[model samples]
Structures are given as C-alpha cells and as structure tokens.
Target chain A: MVMRGLVCLLICLNVVGVCHDVSAGMYDEEEGAFETVSALNSDHRFWDDVRLTLSHVYAYGTSESGAIANRSSLRYEFDTTFFKRFSLRLDGRSSLYWKQDHQAGVDDTNALAQNDLRECYIQAGFDAVSFKAGKQVVVWGETDGDVINDVISPRDEREFVFTNLEDARLGQPMVSMDLYSPWGDVFVFVTLDPKVNETPAPGTRYFRGPAGIRVENEKPDTSDQESGIKWKKIFHQFDLSVMAARLRQNTGVLVYDHSDTYKKKYPSYWFYGMGARYATGSLLFTLDASLKRHYQLQTVDISGRYAGSECLMTDNALGVEYDAGGRYTLNAELTHRHIVNDQDDLAGVKQDTDGLFIQYRRLFLNDTLTCQYRFYHQFQEGHTIHNGELDYLFSDHIRVIMDYTFFRERNQRSYYWTYRNDDRISCEIRYYF
Target chain B: MKKTALICLIMVAFASAAAAGQAREIMEKVDNRNDGQTVIAHVSLTTFRYMTQNGKTRAMEQARIKRMTFVKKDEGPREKDHKSVSILREPKSEQGIGFLQYDYEEVGKETDQWMYLSALGKVKRIVAGNDNEPKTGSYFGSEFNYEDMEAYNLDDFTYTLLGPETYRDTDCWVIEAVPVLRKAKKSNYSRQILWIDKDRDMILKAVLFNRNGKKTKIIMSGNIETLDGILVPRKIVVDNVESRRRTVLLYETIVLNRPVDDEFLRVRTLTDKGYRERKLQEFKDLK
Candidate 1:
C-alpha cells in the first residue's frame, strides 16, 4: 500500500510538474538521467534536471557605404525533463536596431525591434520509437558555411558572427514529423507559407518588401515541404545526410516597371534543391548546389517596362572543415551563383556573383581562451570586395571582436575608385547555469 | 528576542522528532542483533563506466587482485587473533609485480597501506589513516569509498525515519541521513535516503541526492548470508544515474573465526618480505 501510494503521488506531481534548476553542477547528488516528452512539464522530480540560461549582446559598426549601424539583443532559454522519457524546452530572443543617417548619402537612424518564437518542442519515447514535434531547430549538413536543413528562421546577417538561424528558408513556423530506425533517421516539415520573397531588381519596386520597398500583401497559399534523411554509419565513423525542399506561390500578382517605378507580377516563387553532407570525427565535408528559376521584368523595345524575362540561376557551394585536436580548427568555403541567360548582364553589368570565405581558430590556455580570424571576398567581375574579422575569447564567457570590410570598383575608364572600408569593435559576455 | 527564541524552539522540536523516529526504528530492528560475529569475504571488483569527462562515455573491464583475507571478532585470542592482511594488485597489470598491502590493526580504526614496486625491491607506505576520511576519499578511483565497505557508525551522521517502504523484496524503514562534516560534500552523495531491512538492520537500497536536491546515485544490497546468526550482505551494486555507469561487487567466499596467528599481524611481519614468502611456502609444504 505504501509503495502504491508513493507511485500515485509521483504521478500526480508529474502531472503538475514544477521545475527549477538548482544552482549546481550536472553531477548532483541525485544523479539520474533526465528525459522529457510532454507539452505539459510534469514529473519533474523524476525526469526534469537541466540548466537555464540568459544572454545579451550589443554591437556597432560603420560600413564603407557610409552606413553606420547599431544593434542589441536579449535572449532567454528554459530546458527541462518531464517524466522518464520526455523532454521539453523554449527559447526566445528580442533585438533592437538603430542606424546613423548622414555618412555617405541616405540617412535613417530609426531604431526597430524584432522578436520571434524560436523553438518550443516536446519529445516522447515508446519502446524503441521516439518522436519530437513543435517549433524546433532542424540542424543538418557538416559545414558551418553551407548548411541545408538549417532553415528554421532568418538571422541578423550584418554582424560578423550573428547568433541567427542558419537555414532561415526552411524553419517557417512548420510542423515536422520524424521517423527513426537502427539504420537511419528521417524527418519532414510542412510550412504554411512556403515561398520566400526574393530581392527586388534594381530600379524596380515591390509592394510588400520590408521598408515599404515592395507592396505588402498577404502570403500566397502555397504548400512548403522540406525533409531530409540520414544513414547511421559509413565505415563505423562516417555519417551521411541528404535533404530537399520545394514551395509554390498562389498569391496575388506582382508588377515591376522600368521608370524607377517598374512593377511585375510574379505567378510563383519556386525553388528546389538537394544537399549532401558527410562527417568523420574532427573532419567534415559538405556540398550543396541548387537551381533557381525566377521571373524578371525587362524593357520592351527599350521603352516599355513590361518586357519579361524568365532567368535560370544556379548556386553551388562547397565547404570543408578540419579540427586539429584541441589546438586549432580551419574552415574554407566558396559559393558561386550564375544566371544562365543572354541577359545575365543586365543594364551593362554582370549579374553572376561569387563569394569565398576562410576562417581559422585557435584554442589556447587550455580552452579557457581562443582566437579566430575570418576572411570574406565577394566578386562579380567589375565589383570585388573583401572583409576581414578577428575575435578573441578572453575567458570562457567573454569575447572581443573586430571586423574590417573593404570595397572597390573599377570604372569604364579603367580607373580604380577610392577604396571604401567598414569597421566594427565590440565585446560581449555570456554565462550558463 | 522573542522571535529568535521561538525559532530556536521550533528547530529543537523538529530535531527531537526526527531523532525519536530514527531511534524507534533502529531499536525495533537491532534489538535482536546483539553480539553477533562479523565475517569478511574475498571478492573481485568490476565496474562499468556510464559517464566520462565527455558526455555518454563508457568503458568496462576486469581488475586484478593478488590476495584477500578474512577477519572476525571472538571472546579470546586464538591462533588467528589480530592477524589480517590483503595484497591488492593493480587494475591493469604491468611488466613486473605491483601490489598494495592492507595491514589491519587490532582495536583501532587505522589501516596501514604499503605498495610494493618490483623495481624498488621495497614496500612503500602510501596511506595511513583511521579508516575515515582518507580511506573513503578514493579506492582505485571506483565509486565505493572505504567507509562504505566498513561497518556503519551512528556517529557518522544523524538519521531520521521518514517512514517505511519496500526495497527490492524486503520491507524496510526509510531513513534520511545527513553527514556531519563540511568536507563530506565531496562524497558520492550530498545526502542519503536509505531503506534498511526491518528484520536485519541491513540497508537494502540507498538513494543518494546531489547538493542540488536531485537524485544522482542508487546503491542496492543483496544476497544475504548469516554467520553466527549475524546477517550480512554478500553483494552490492552502485548505479550512477546521469552517467549510466554501474559497479558490482560479488564475493566468492566468506569465513569467520578462522585460525590465524598474532605474530603474523605484527608490524615486523608486514615489513618482512622474506617472512611472508617463507610462511606461504610452509603452508604449501604442509599440503
């Protein structure tokens, strides 16, 4: 009778679970594996045991284009176990942005705030089968540079190392289904809004683009699907994964014009791509190439803005990473995008652009300290630019970062324009419990 | 002053209640367990790593031991009085002979530890303590402390009977124990809740909590054996919750009141390597 009562009491507490991570190390006296699987956090004493964390960061930078920007963000996270085979967590972030208006030309220093419900998920286990669903981060690929399934949400890209989501394309408030077996794992996601709006052509306008650059309209009814599969073992250590996705727009028409007010109606924003990744211990390799076909407005008879062009574009990316014990890690990657059409050169400029990135980091002071250097170069024949960044982790929780970006252009007269540069200096502190 | 006095009184009342419950439970169980002979057993130790420095790490294997001894209490001095010795070998065998000697002391808590290095040709004293903190700190880096293997002392901690429960198959009284010293923080458990068998006063299972109030380790006792009417646990298993690690102790033999000589337990006997060799040789020669 006593044991039965105790078990019932534990079950009741599990239903109305309360979890508060004590301020102690993971090796607590009551050390049992913590697991979670329910939407309601219950059975805390039996399964809930983990740390909670909060962080904040602020940064300022001036670009060669004379654009000065400042940004800050605050983030909070809660993770805990519920029941013996379930776990759940929530992460939230809010950011503020401000800019200086006068440096080179356009001046707008309005501060803006943006926040998204990042991830809220629960995991469950039944015999050998387990499932996790809700808003969650789907991380795939073996390279930091070319991620495939990382498409949960867009991140701030202006900073050197923005704590943003990688595959911003796929994680669009979607419901995901996962299946696991001894041989491999597979998962699929369904999104409400599938198509991602593309950048407006220069000298053209959009109705719904951010900053009123485009006419804002309700997202078209299009089914967005993304999924991936992974094989458990390849030569005992190697892991392999493949992923793909597609989205079609069924919304209102988009129009582009040539008189700096040109408009075009887009029937759909459709893209499909496949990616592959492999990893072995400290070494990782990734390759992702996708073809994109989009509608573009062209000047008809050199006068009207209604002439249209359907351009076929291809993007290729390759990334490699090597971790040399605890001493250093080196990563190198390149991305090339090409528009396959006679009009690839639009208005006397090549539309094809290529980008390169290389980064090296060293962990000294027994991993208590670290230093990193990164280089980025983007090119489109006449317009070539390079950016450099250096960061040092002064301690386990503190970091100092520096970035310099250089821009250069060549005129028809073969004269090189004055070099334009941007730089930023910042420091941040982080702690976990 | 009135509030302080009230708070002090409340604390005193709670402590007294806790003590009364513990004493009542202990008395009920140990009333029939007086003046019983205790027996030591020879056993091999094995442990499986469920946790490592890195997460989800594990390793497993067997250990090596050179010798083991049995000790007991009696009314009068016999041939085997006060003589106890055990040579523990290194877990991973190396090129030559490498072992440690556990020299038992009579009527005291201290146990002398001397390690023999084949290259040195001498026995080196590695540890000397009253079988308390030092012995309990480490034993071949396994989870079991020396105190955990010895007799339980009431003075080591304050115990309170929370209630009763069934542990494995035994009906037991649930007791909560709080260590007395500040340094006890480094022990496997910050606090312990044990389910002691109501009939034999043997702990059937103990749930250890971390300083953070989380359950971290579980120790279960099994395979009871009786020697001169004293019940003893012949096997024990310790499980680390977070690391998924486990260590099991199984004894192969148990003996009590065996024939042993006093001279064999002397300090000189421990130091004389030739004497040890000659004694073993004489035993072999007798057979």
Candidate 2:
C-alpha cells in the first residue's frame, strides 16, 4: 500500500508543473499574467541549462529470504555563467528508501529519507590562470574500478559496487587553481572539509561486524586542511600526470572499547602518485601507481594481533582498453599492492596482494539500448564478483535499467564471502526533464 | 612545313600546361577561401526517413539543435590540423552530450574522436582507424556522416576541372576529386563531383560516388551569405540514394573569425557544464 502511494506521488510530481500552470490560469487573468511574468523572470535565459532527473529503483536479493529494497530519488542540476568569465554550477539530490525485513529482528527501517548537495562551485579563468572555489569532486586516475591514484575524493560505499562509481563520489569543499602553459597544466588544491568514505550501517546486509558491536566515526577537525598539487600534460601520444598530496587516511584505525563499540580515528598521511595513458589505433594502455604511508589498526586479520602498526603501502595498476567496431568496448586492469614495515606477527597486513578487473560494454539500436558486464577478482583473497546490466531508452524522457550482481569466494576467509548469499537483481526507471 | 608542325606541337604543350596550372590555382583559392582561424555556429538538423508501404510514401522526422566550434592550426607547409567540438543542446534527454574531434590534414593520419556522456558523467575516447566508418551513428540518423561534416583538405585528394557549367540558373565550376592513394585506402567514396559557385567561391552542390562507382549521395547547399568576409551556407540538404533518406541542416547563426579563447577548446569544457556554458555564452556574445 505504501509502494502504491509512492508511485502515485512520483507520477504526480513528474507532471506537477503542467498541472500547476493549467490550474493557475483557469479563472483569473491578472493572476495568470503575474505568475507568467514571475516565472519568466525567475527562469531567465541564463538558467537555460537547468536539468532535473527522477528515478525509482526496485531491488531484490536472489535468496530464500527474498529481501527487497525500494528507492526513489530526484536530482536537479543547474549551470550558468555569472560574469563574463566566471561560471557557476549547482547539483543536489533528494532520495527515499524502504527496505523489507529479511528476518524477524532485522527490520532495517532507519534513515529512510536523505538529502545531499553533491557539488556547488564557481570558477573563473584569467588568461593562463584559472581558479575554482566551493564544493567539488576531483578525480586523478586513469584505471577503471581501481583506487591507486584516485584517492583524492571520498566515496559512499553503503551500496558497495552496486552504485555507479561517479554517483558514489562525494564532493569536498576546496579551492583550486590551474596554471596553463605550453608544456603542461599545473594545478593546486586546498580542501577545507575532507569527507571520509561512508560505509554500510551496522544492521545492513553489507555491514562487516558482529551483531552486538557499534561503530563510531571520529572526523578530524576542520582546521586540519589537506592540500595537493598535480601536473598534467599530453606529450606525443601519451597523456601523463603526477600528483602529491597530504591527506587524512580514508580507512581509519579502529579502537575497540569495553562496551563493544569501535571508535574510528583518522590519521594524517602523505600520498604521491603518477599515471599515464597512451592510445594506439583502437587500443589504449594506462598505468597508475601511488604510495601512501600512515599508522592504522590491522583490521584485515581475523586474529586481533598487530592491532596498531605504522606501515607504508604502494599500489600499482596497469590497464588496457580495446574498442571494437560496432559500439563495443572492453577494458581490463591488473593491480598489485606491496606493504612495508608490517608487523611479522600480523596475518592481515600481507606483504603483497593482487586484484584484476574486467569490463565489457555493447550498445545496440542506435545507442538506445546498452548492455555491460564487469568482473572483479582479488587474487590474494580468492574472491570474485560479477555484475551485469541492461539499459533501454523507452523515449527521450524515459529509460529503464536492469542489473544483476553475483559474488563467489574460494574460501570463507575472504571478506566478500560474508555477502556470498547477498546476490541481488535490481530494476530502475528514470525520467529526465 | 616541318617548322610549322614544330610550332603547333609547342603551342599544344603550352596550352595543356596552362590548363593544369589553372586547376591547381583554382583549388588553392578554394582552400584559402574556406580556411578560418576560428568559427562558431548554431545549427538545427532535421532528418527525414522515407519509406514505401503498399505503394504509399511516408516520412518520419527527427530534429536536433547543436552548437559547434572549429579551430585550425598550421602544422607545416603542406599539413594543417583542425580541432572541433560539437555540443548537443536540444532534445533534453541528450542535453550536455558533446563530441570532440581532432582532424589532421595529412593523408593516412587518423582522426581522433571523444564523446562526453552527461548521464555517465564521463568522457569516452572513440578509437577508430579512419573517419570513413559508418559506425559514427549517421549524425542522429541523418544521411550526413561524420566525414561529410568534416572540413575538406586540398592535399588529401587530387582535383580535376571538368568544365564550366550552370547549375540551377547559377554559373558554377564543375570539378571532380579523387582521393589520393593513402586517402583512398580508408575512404569509402571513390570520387566526388562538386559544383562550386564561381562568384561566391563556395561549394553549392556535391555528388558522391561509392567505391563501386555508383552514385550514393547528393548534397545541395543554399541560402548563401557572407560573414566576416567569408562565404557561408545557411542551409544544407543531404540525400542518400540507396536508403532514400534525407537530412537538412539549417544554420541559425554563423560567426567567423571570432575571438574564441584557446582554453574553451580543451577537454574540460566537454565534461564541465559550467565551463561549457560560459564558453558558449562568450561565443554567443560575439555574434
């Protein structure tokens, strides 16, 4: 019954503008004129790029429990020019979700409503230099589904890989400047509010802990700002970039208290990374590597030994993308990580680990229909994940998407094995205006 | 008698040389006349798909609005390169979509293309061996392909002056162009015949022949006007003979030699909505 009401509400909101305009002018002339003028002046030519999107998603686990999750969201984006050289943009989303009970005690009914301001920024260009301020997202890597050099922006991992990577990115408040030159572009950024990745709630299926334990996040002070610099250039046939930053460690150290609660403490770290892309004919090759050093609790081990340790980690990834004719693309990446100064007694902080990711996409029917398949394999943990998606455009304003995700593990010790039974299928309908 | 014959032979040789020289000169004039440092334009495209059912003719129409900018650079004495970006503005579903292209005038050099999809919020580089591939999606289901919209370079083809002709009550120079060996290996068309308006120094009509020497397409341009001392075509129609499809492009506004900032042509403009809008506004204000 609640689902029916929500559906009706969404439909009404889709056509509310037309209904409002018709009813406003039905019986009054002066009132209609006043409304029209107000609308015209409010939505001036400068606001012509405003856009809105509404989507409803239904997801269900393919298990005996038959858990279902329904979500609806409305997103709005506006972009325009203020002065002659300055540009301003705003984007926001409002979402609602309802999850059905999987078991008697697992109600999973909390924080059903949410609102987020994704990005709001203003930028100006002056000859060879440009400056941008406000909340924004900055990505720094070329590999797909890899996080080596792309650690600048935080992510919302509540839904894990089920969510689009770009959508999962959370913006940070920052000021950035770019200096353009013939050789390359030099960029510097200072972030005031650096957000940490949001993990799944304690009671959720993706949560990783015992039932009685609670998690508390301790964000750093606002005065502890992060800074980064990047230099990017296209030389010959290669696109190259190098960056260095001082950042708050994304995965904080977990300190367990007497009451079975864990406090997440974020520490400061230094990161340096570099990446390059070279394209030849229909194939593109990419390489990225980054090094980070910090102190953190060794959370990966089942045994609670080496709980606190200072270590340096290096991650490197090599990827290739091949484009076959007829709107088909394939991408593959292999990543390797190495840790230094690890405690010998700890089982979690392995000296070396590797991961591989692959993705394929094909478009049909004049690009109105799209199909994609992706696979991720963690070699050290022997865990694999498979995701497939189908999207069809019903018209210019409406689209339908279906997705299925599966996980497999060689052993129960792998982290992904915790959700081996959480395989799910999802369907979504979207309207654009 | 021998002396007179010798003189006649020399005269014939001089005349043939003059004809060849004139052809090259005319081609150079066409090239120089069409080249512009920077150009910005707003265009409306309407495509008509024709079908026959039970001896009845029916047509389906699709409309689109786009803003395009083209910038050129001289690579060397014989080579030039062009960078062009097209942003889709209308049909709200496809809004914020953009295409960026880098075209090199030298034969055998591949053209680079990238598409920015706003829904995915990512820019995808399209890697293709040649620009003649039909997989570019036919310009929104129109008869015009990406190669048809590309700027022509004189060095890629060899042109021959057919003769002086009159087309549609206007005097024109008929010329036939065959792709060079390097270009022919990648091009789908065997030859193209152009009807150039002598007075305006612009192409008014063109007929394209497939690799099999069959007439495949016809393009007609009208509504000629001059902007910034350059001849511009306000309207164009392309008819595909095989598919019986037609595409019409109407230019709402055309500005040439505009003060377009080099930064506006960067890849960031394709992915950054605010930057794209600001650059577009600057281009519009120029008009």
Query: What are the models' TM-scores?
Result: 0.44, 0.83
| Model 1, span B1-287: residue lDDT tens | 99999999999998879776765558445533543433444444444443465453344322212123333332234211222444332221111233333323233433333344422222333333321222233333345554455434454566677777876556888888876673253234567888878867777788888656789778876666675565756556667675565655544455554444443433333333333333333233110
lDDT of 2 by residue, A1-433 (tens): 5556755655665555312221121122111211211121212354366878888777788863565567778888888767777887788999877655221115556437778998899988665777899998887788876789888788888776677886887888999998878878888999987888877766665777555666677768975579999998865457789999998766667766546677676777889999888777768888999988773535534545224466788889999988754457889999998887645744565678899999999877545688999999989899899999998865555668899998887878776777888889988877777
Computed on alpha carbons, the lDDT of every model, listed in order, comes to 0.45, 0.71
Q: Kindly report which residue stretches of model 2 are placed more than 4 angstroms away from their true locations once superposed.
A: A1-46, A63-67, A98-111, A222-224, A295-297, A300-308, A342-345, B1-29, B52-58, B61-79, B107-143, B159-176, B209-217, B240-246, B271-287
Model 2: fnat (fraction of native contacts) = 0.25
Interface RMSD of 2: 11.6
The first chain of model 2 has a TM-score of 0.85
Tens-digit lDDT string for candidate 1 (A322-370):
6553246677888777778776334332456677768787754323244
* C-alpha RMSD over true interface residues, each candidate: 24.7, 11.6
Q: Which residue window of length 10 is worst by lDDT in model 2 chain A?
A: A33-42
**Candidate 2 clashing pairs?**
none
DockQ of each: 0.01, 0.20
TM-score (C-alpha, index-matched) for candidate 1: 0.44
